[model samples]
Target: MSNVTGSFQLMKSLNRSLVLNKIRSAGAVSRAAIAKETKLTPPTVTNIVNELIESNLVRESEMGTSKGGRKPVLLTINDQEFFIIGLDVGARKIRGVLTDLNAKELVADHAALYQDISADQLTERMTQMIEDLIQSAGVERTQVVGVGVGMHGIVDHEQGVARFAPTYHLKEIPIKEQLETAVKLPVFVENDAKAMALGELWFGAGRGCDNLIAVNIGVGIGAGIIFNNRLYHGHNAVAGELGHTIIDINGSPCSCGSFGCLQTVAGGDSIAERAARELASGRESLLREKIAGKDEINGEIVYECALAGDQLCIDILQETGRYLGVGMTNVINLMNPAKLIIGGGVSKAGDFILGPLQDVVSQRALTDEVKQTNISTAELQEHATVIGAVTIVLADLFTPDLLNAK
Candidate 1:
């Protein structure tokens, strides 16, 4: 390519990126507004915006009425123009969703695993699923920013290695490199709980809150901490292992080989185990009817019964909440976050889980801390972590250097 041609191409790319950034920062705006904010000439803004329109990245909306002359055409990011893929890998299933720039779901697909799949098989299946999602969403290959996977375990984001995931029996696997090589696009791996926390911080209940903590109550308890307006992953990406916190010195054994950890008492498996035993002993409640012939019970079943107002189900939830609250009170004392958000499948019980939770928090937490902090359920439900994964890709893809590079 000619040097002059290359220079012009570089300039065009930088200008387009700048225009896109302006729209992202300001929301729906006019070309004049972008020019003013970016300090670029009106002609440059107009040219860049036209290129964006051709690329389907931005769109022109109705013009506002002018007090004197012609109305200015309003510009808005085409939330539907492009998409990103997000996958949340859980012990029981793999949930994938394709979303637009605004994080609106376009298509979603999930697969259940009877048993753990090998790392290679998992990545291969996940790649196929992503291809299916793109075709299902009718998005072009170039339109997708990348894929982000939220895994349950210690993640080395810098190296893209999943140190270990007990649920999947995976250890020290290069998740990002493998997925990226297979899918031929950028890939990111993050702790599932941390991803959910970012999702909450960006677009869910934690929006506008700088200091927040998101506790994920699922197969096992985990936490996502956002401190000083940034997601805090700690030194080795193990900062939010709240479930492993020793709550009882002689308590029930945990998978981590510890005694009296929060996971021993509040994890989904533990909850199911307790319910099973209670039912076997002929507890008089709807749970017996719900699991009449079933040999095993799961967290979802428990939540359904709890929502149905089964006396035994409510009792279980209340007791679980009490224990969770005890842990949370400690969280408040340690993090002192502005708000605490609860998420994951168990959160489906809503106030059945949160009401008793708060009661305990009030009782155990420092009176002053309790008064200053608030607790709420995650607004994104099961989608928080997945959407947060997508956010990670977008934030990385749209940075000044990357977006502006020719």
Candidate 2:
């Protein structure tokens, strides 16, 4: 009897969520329209919608045009009053945003991450940012639905733990537990790149593509995989470690302790290292004028120089693109995602890198269709990862009672 009751409740919840999502997708819809679209009986739709309205998540709007006589009352999502907080945890900084239910950013804030900061210290900084963002947005804490964090490295999203944040050399950090404890709000933690994929799906480049990949090529390389409109977290949650894929057994040593991982040659850190090495080898370029020494020649500086038309910087970016193309080809052949979206600092190089990367893909991909697989830059730019942080909470909120887990 108990199991049967539980199943009944689950079905009801699923139907409610279905009706709500139909309303959301339809923008402004009549109750009859929602019932027809979701295949729910009118009575069930009415009950669920009434419950949603009471919960302040849905509302009755203006009347829709009538076919003949009476106009239908339009129903819409109560998005304006709802809020969510998003955080992007990076190697040296943590960026945050306050957004509405529609994921429109309302306020943004950030804090630095010292190289040697402890796990507890990091959570403190994140909690403080969430607090500060709520104040900045002038919203009551209760108005904010939840906090979402996009953390780098292997993340146990189910447990809301950052299993390993490579930048801080931290392991098994209890991000969700600590933040929820501090803020008294729900917290979700996800890998930075995975979050970016979700953000792109709903609000950016990967929109309209159910199966896609978003690669973040920053200080390190990472990838987020979305299949059938859902994130694919592999067994043990290391599914998107695209950076650690070994392409060059005898190539340079990677931070992952592997020889010739894709990140070793294509990541932002590698871009800078390559530039610095050229400079150290007495290759002359405009970078020498901007930097005091080779050590100061980071990836951003190299990009700046490239934009300033430094031939060496441009060539290095081109080479990096080719390497990325090679790495992407392997994955494309393996996964054959509908699209590949590139994000992060190195991607900011734009045509300097993209042209070559595309060239390599065009020349090397196994099939003609695969070669033309709609590779584009991430639409959200630098905010991609952070906004993705906001999206995890949104995903949870939107997918509460789905029959199949996303």
Model 2's lDDT to the true fold?
0.86
Against the reference, the lDDT scores of all candidates come to 0.80, 0.86
**Least lDDT summed over 10 consecutive residues: which range in candidate 1?**
397-406
Where does model 2 exceed 4 Å of error? 1-12, 293-295, 400-406
Per-model C-alpha RMSD: 4.7, 4.0
**Highest-TM-score candidate:** 2
- Tell me the tens digit of each residue's lDDT in model 1 across 126-238: 78888889899887776776788888878776677889887877798888888877776678888889889878877899988879999998988889888877778787678
For 1-406, candidate 2 gives per-residue lDDT tens digits of 1232223234446677687777777789998888788888999889888877877788998769978977779999899878889999988799999999888999998887888899999999999999999898898886887888999998888889998888788899999999888887878888899999989988899877889999998988899999877788876788889999998889998777779899989988899888988989999999999897554778888889999999999999999999999988888999999999999888999998899988988999999999898999999999999999888877766654211233
Least accurate stretch of 10 residues (summed lDDT) in model 2?
1-10
